[model samples]
Target: MSNITTAPFTYESLSQLTMKEGVLELQVGPAHAGSGHMRILVWVEGDTVVKVDPDIGFVHRGVEKLSEDRLYVKAIPIVERPNLVDTVNANLGYIIALEKLLGLEAPPRAQYIRVITAEISRIISHLYGIAIYGIFMGSSTVFMWALADREPFIDIMEELTGARLTYSHIIPGGVRWDLPKDFGERLEVALKYLEGRVSDYEKIWMNNPVVRARAEGVGILSGAKATELGVVGPNLRASGVKCDVRKCAPYSVYSDFDFDVPTFKEGDSYARLLIRVEEIKQSISILRQALKNIPEGKIIYEDYYKRMTPLMKSIYDEKGRVKFTSLLTSLSPPKGQSFSRVEGGRGEIFFYLISDGTKNPYRFRVVTPSFRNLPYFTHVMPGHKLADVPVIYGSIDYFPPEADRR
Candidate 1:
């Protein structure tokens, strides 16, 4: 085995080794095979990678800067665009921070609904990550099955929020709509079907000898190193660090649900893969609890609910949707700053907002999980073979669009 170094790699350090003997430099892509929307610069000695530097910013939409120009309510869709597979959690993080500055809280029913959709979004994201990982491992069957199973959950989200990928269903004060009349029935069926499919996945993919051979001991990240690197979500938990933003800092009725944060001590590529599977099970458990025990109440805050016009109230009464008033578009909170964080599908999504008591935000900043997890490419790829690059990248479930959203 090649000696693995744990020191941080910077552009200056990488530049210093530019023309070292017996080393070859390679650029992975802004056009990815499976690494998503960023480029990776890899330096290899023989067949082992000696260094890696991720070149991000390909998908930079300047979401934070853009949020400053739009109204608080309008920024929901803008923020959701960065991480389409897990939009609800991103939406939830921003809404929670904005609510703190606005001095508002979502109604109990709205909080519960938010929890339900967030879990559903978590499931959708995990399945997408698993599918992409399967493709990286050359298992077309796993890829297809994982993606096909995602459709049922996507349909459920569309039923509730009226949008497939980017729901933008969450607003500053609360969710945009209440649960559909048949939502419970559809969710039950989908959850049951997915439970059976999980078993099938275990049998065909997780337990397969070929997969185990490839992933079991590859790209190990020790728990200490993981914490030092500030890894989050399944990647952090996979290394046996018992830290989840939801458990550490409960937000939006997450404290009301019963679920376990799964962790594995192996810290290898296989452990990272399995932790996501376990998380899917926990998300399902949360969904069941949220659905069964949800209280009946208005979906928006009382203040926002009271501002509904007669026509809007009638529409909400007849269709269960919350129509926004013009007041929301001109919302200006007190001149103060607030921060909020949520456990997203990939990891902890954090938002910082500064309000100058204007119609638009003074400043908006987001630290996405994928951006936090980006250092893994430099830290974990150095000692592995060139071919193991994709394995390590896929194992971390790094989404480039989310990472590059400056």
Candidate 2:
């Protein structure tokens, strides 16, 4: 065999090359929505993308480092701050790791409540992502309807957690509060409204000729490729992968509920979009089951309960909620390392924590779905038309803050 050599394609060489032969370079974004202020460099040969480089980290805030500085309980707020729409899901991973280190599990009633809140957050996050997807695809009506539908869920969250977003509701021992007396009825009404609206969404967005032509078969990711790339959540399921943290690992009370993991063989932007819609329906089903079979019992672990003052205990008894004091800041679990995984709106989220029997953790690490899904863009974007970039990116619902937190 003859020896062969290839030179690296550096920016300096590209700049030095002639601007002929239909080779063009362009920049897309600083995207305005979904992930804010993120850019992608596109190299085009005629109208087709020859290569694309994603530019991220516009909103990095060192979330993992911040976690190491804060106390164990106080870090809940810091953990979910990156992904506000999926607060309960984002917090669940960290809380699970914490509980593992502490060797405690939330009560059965608490587990059910956690499921209820987490599924609601999943619905909210999917709505927000789908709305953004609609806007990116130039369907303002879809954006308007999906966002308007989201308010009811947010209203319910406010009632449950006393916050519209960044709830910090999921704690190590259990959730923060018991369900309200009227929550079941309100949720049923909301789910019904959403179920009806989903059909409208199908008619106006999914089945629309323009949307179907633009999204269907565009940015196809084969099942083998999706698995090889380690894509997660709806993006992975859209490619016909039968994997879900809830179904496979069954953390929390996910095993108690029965809901299908939606999959599509098309593995395109359209399939990704529809998977999320089906997941929303599944989440509604889960919520109905959880609400119907929810048990009545303690919301927090007995160990934590015994440490509460009489006045605080009285408040908990009256309000069905616990008020944590700064005294928890001194908590130091036994020396150990633990990891947790949860299904977020976009995909799977993972947390790895190391404790050294100190006021602060020795290490805190996170792998968000958005972060894991990012590689798929580099792998799939080439050979598609330049216009297809945003469609594929939006379909993935890449949240930069969550991705860049590390």
Candidate 3:
């Protein structure tokens, strides 16, 4: 190790670091500065930012460590609590990795359930993004509107899964329950309602002059830069690229669905916002199709669902709560590593699972969308006014702090 000397710093140290040297100091809440409220220190020599040291740990929850003591099955719900906006994506990613590790796969019907829930999750996630974007831009009307619109999707998930947000539905081999009575009918109606609501989102925020001004040509990340930064989902697509994990690397029953991946070339905050709005509509289309063609095969894998006792079956049929097969109590995956990435509402979410064929996982790692996208705050902050920080931050849809596996 090399010992080097660095200058003394402050909590709100967003001052002229060195006037003679032209070195500016950017105080990061969690990126730079002291860890009071998570600030970032942006030091500029002349026109470029030199260092972006993060001062985080403001809201550090031991999610990964908590999973280590918990059985593999128990970790599913706990791992998803940090990023509530995209719970389905988190649950699916973790379970898929576990399934791969254990050499198990959900049946065809179970896969369909995964797709429906995942797409619905996509809608809710985007709704949160747009609302956050709206509030940041001083447009509470759109925020209120988006939040209200999201309620129906949440309610649908509740009816189908017996819980609204923390849907610990997707387990190792398959989902927890079958759809409730008239499940398909409710889904179809919800999809239709969402289809109409999506258009309204566009009219209200996507292309509105004020929102566009705050976003257009702002924080423009080129296609190459986006890829280099390891961004994914609509964020990558906004840079004029046609890359979506669902279509390019189809998971679960996604390959069977017909949907378009919305992309734009502008590569700015505005473009990212518009791309997500378009993506929401595509999700509605998929939801409609999923319910329209839901088959009557055993809702869960026969190897699993067939064994459910009458008591368990009653709980499932009436409330759509899945009764787990006993095997989940101690999911001892093989002593190997598995990594899986899925398109989350914020961007691409990754899961790294290591098992020793024991009741608990040996090691687990996760990468959230906001954590990966934090670099945007540095690149876009300097050129704009001080007040525009939150607006741009909102436009980028920065999320709550999540766990870092290390």
TM-score for each predicted model, relative to the true structure = 0.97, 0.94, 0.86
Top-TM-score structure, candidate number: 1
Better of 1 and 3 by TM-score: 1
Pairs of residues clashing in candidate 1: none
Off by over 4 Å in 3: 1-37, 42-54, 306-321, 403-406
Tell me the lDDT of model 1 at 194. 95
Worst 10 residues of 3 by lDDT: 1-10
lDDT of 1 by residue, 1-406 (tens): 2244444555566666777888899889877685678889989999988889899999998999999999888898899989888999999999999999999998899899889999999999999999989998888888899999999999999988778889888887778888888899999999999999999999999999988888888888899988998988899999999999888889988888778989999898999999999999999899999889999988888888788899998988887788878978888899999999999999999899999999888999999999999878988888788888998898999998999887
Candidate 2 weakest lDDT stretch, 10 residues: 1-10
Report the Cα lDDT for candidate 3.
0.74
Candidate 1 at 38: error in angstroms? Answer: 1.0
| Clashes found in each candidate (C-alpha, N, C closer than 3 A) | 0, 0, 22
TM-score of 2: 0.94
Residue 242 lDDT (model 3): 81
